[model samples]
Target: MIIIFIASLILFAFLYMVSRNKYDEFIEPLDEKEFKIKKIMPIGFWVMDKINYRYASKYDRNLLNKTAELNGGVYAHYYLRVHWANKITFELMLLMFLLFINGAMGKTDMELIIFSLLVMAVVAYALDKDLENKVSKRRLSMQIDFPDFLNTLTLLINAGMTVSGAWTRIVTDTKKSTPLYSELRNVMLEISNGKSEIGAYEEFAKRCRLPEVTKFVAVITQNLKKGNSELVDILKYQSKECWELRKHAAKRLGEEASSKALFPMMLMFFAVVLVVVTPAIAGLIGSV
Candidate 1:
């Protein structure tokens, strides 16, 4: 028990220092073949990349893209993100193995089985939660970028480019580095590979899975099917619509912020009340 407690403290302290200094993030990218894990546990992680490559290569391209996003599209490129995920899973499994063995040393068979299963369950949940968080953050960033995206598209359309032309122009010319832009770049790749404009837009809208993006896709598809004479007007309207949504979102955020402030405000109010009432109560007690 003491050993476990001491080990936990050391682990926590190391984690704190690593997080504060961002030690893991300091490592520069290396070729997968050349990548070597020179660390405490050599059991799982050293060959993780090769294993990840073999497994990742088996996934369909779309699934691979999603895996990349969940692993970490914001901080690292897709390949690097996959590599990171592989490494993380490997290290976690190795740690869990060591901890499980330590825990099972004096335990009966049933107890050991239950404890190992519980640890595995908790580790699985944590990994899923981390992936979900990363994916949500990516989508949130795309949602936030929508209004600006609309404005750019509207500008290009009003300047007399075809919707497809405007999309290509924006994808090529825009300097902003966001998930939306990254997705649009992929859309351009599809278009350049002989996919129809509508098909590419549909793919983009589907992948984004946001109502705002879906609405924009619907408008673009309708314009494409019915001839694009109203393209500029449609884009102008979308720009306005996106901006209105942004306003509503901002208002909700403010309300949430106000609600969060109430707890602190209540604490301060009670502290003031205690300060004012304490002396009177003391006087009464002294007189009694």
Candidate 2:
């Protein structure tokens, strides 16, 4: 048993080292300037510290930042936390399962430990899939609201407000009620603090990466450059298209719900008929 425990520890250490190195290979370090900026920002600082503590290397931080950059860089901290937490949770679960299996099977500790590592690998894969699904759902919801947001901007612009002024008005009016509203509000704040409208819009597009938002930004940027006056019409058309899409989505959801309920509804109907006829059938049999 003692030898087994020693061997298990060695194996676990080796695998952990291998995974850590692979994670390092996947990430490139940020420059000294970016690293310093990350340290100053509260959220970035937390993410950096968390990654360092969990991963025991700077490479983990790079991996997380790269992943976030790939997704548009706005939610890097959130993604890092998600990935770290998921890995920790899976590891803990695997450890517990291994301990349980060892006690039940009277196996050597090393065998159980190896089995636990295998389980953790499987769990990590499943957790990644679950996270992807969640992110996709959130992106879809944000996209659904983009057209209405664009229309609101267009209306404000047409009514004699400057683009910045229109965004400020919308920010006040929205009061951050929706996800899109909050994101827009942040963009507005960025603009208020000296960022150019075009730069802010570009950042917003990067964060969202939705086709509608990209197209809207392209149109607005062009109009700004060319002094175009037809933005209001374009906004109206986009709004109408988005509304139609939303309606279609709603209809589809409703049909899916109805289809799912159909089976239970038929079962209930048959059950009610059987209950009503059973007594009459018994009475007729008694007469016979």
Candidate 3:
């Protein structure tokens, strides 16, 4: 166990030395929350680059891109690389920690080694699952906010505003800093920075990856391309549909909250039972 620990430690130290500062300028600006274990990310990237590992398959790459797009189109590729790097770095770190613990405790058994490997595997799986959960949460948030945004846009357009003007107004005037609003703000920024209006909206839909947003973008793009006379009516109808989606999203959140509370409630119930039963049982024993 000590030998294994020393070898793994040396290997990681050497790898870190070789990979250190290789991508600092590129990685320093990443959000610590999204790109956790940030200190090891450069090393992970270096290892990935050296091994020429893009992803396991095209489907894997696509799957990652679907979630990565939420960050931004320009950074989609970076996030994909970082996602894999984070997973690799976390698993390697866990392996080293497990080996060190086993060595220090002087418990060098084959079963311990096997168990450590399983633990590392589970950690890797959980890390990947974390990314999926992040995307799910972002999606739910955007869904819950979409109906209000649609309604506001409909009002602005009805009040003698152009589609672009209404969009800019909504993004600029709104104070809520949510994922949906942030994406809307990005769309406005892109358009103002000389990106074509239709192109910006299309990118927004791709980033959102929601059916309602996609349909909304299609309607807007059609309006931009062919000048829809019924755009307001279409938006109002979509807004109603989004309200339904929002309700479902809210219900799902409530369900999740209840489920999370269930375990604690059960624990409290058990605690109360023990507290009430202990004195009675003790008195019975003393009397006997």
TM-score per candidate: 0.56, 0.61, 0.91
RMSD versus native structure for model 3? 2.2
Q: Tell me the lDDT of model 1 at 129.
A: 59
Top-scoring candidate (TM-score): 3
Better of 1 and 3 by lDDT: 3
Residue 127 displacement (Å), model 3: 1.0
User: In candidate 2, what are the lDDT values of residues 151-217, reduced to their tens digit?
Assistant: 7888888889877788788778775555567668878888879998899988887766667778778
Worst 10 residues of 1 by lDDT: 38-47
Q: Which residue segments of model 2 deviate by more than 4 Å?
A: 1-78, 107-119, 251-288
Estimate every model's Cα lDDT from 0 to 1.
0.67, 0.65, 0.87
lDDT of 3 by residue, 1-288 (tens): 789899999999988889887988767888897676898777788889999985769866765676565677677777778777777888788889998989998878888889988998898778777777888999999999999989999999889898899988888889999999999998888988999999999989988989999999999899899998899999999999999999999999999999999999999999999999999999999999
Off by over 4 Å in 3: 33-36, 104-108, 280-288
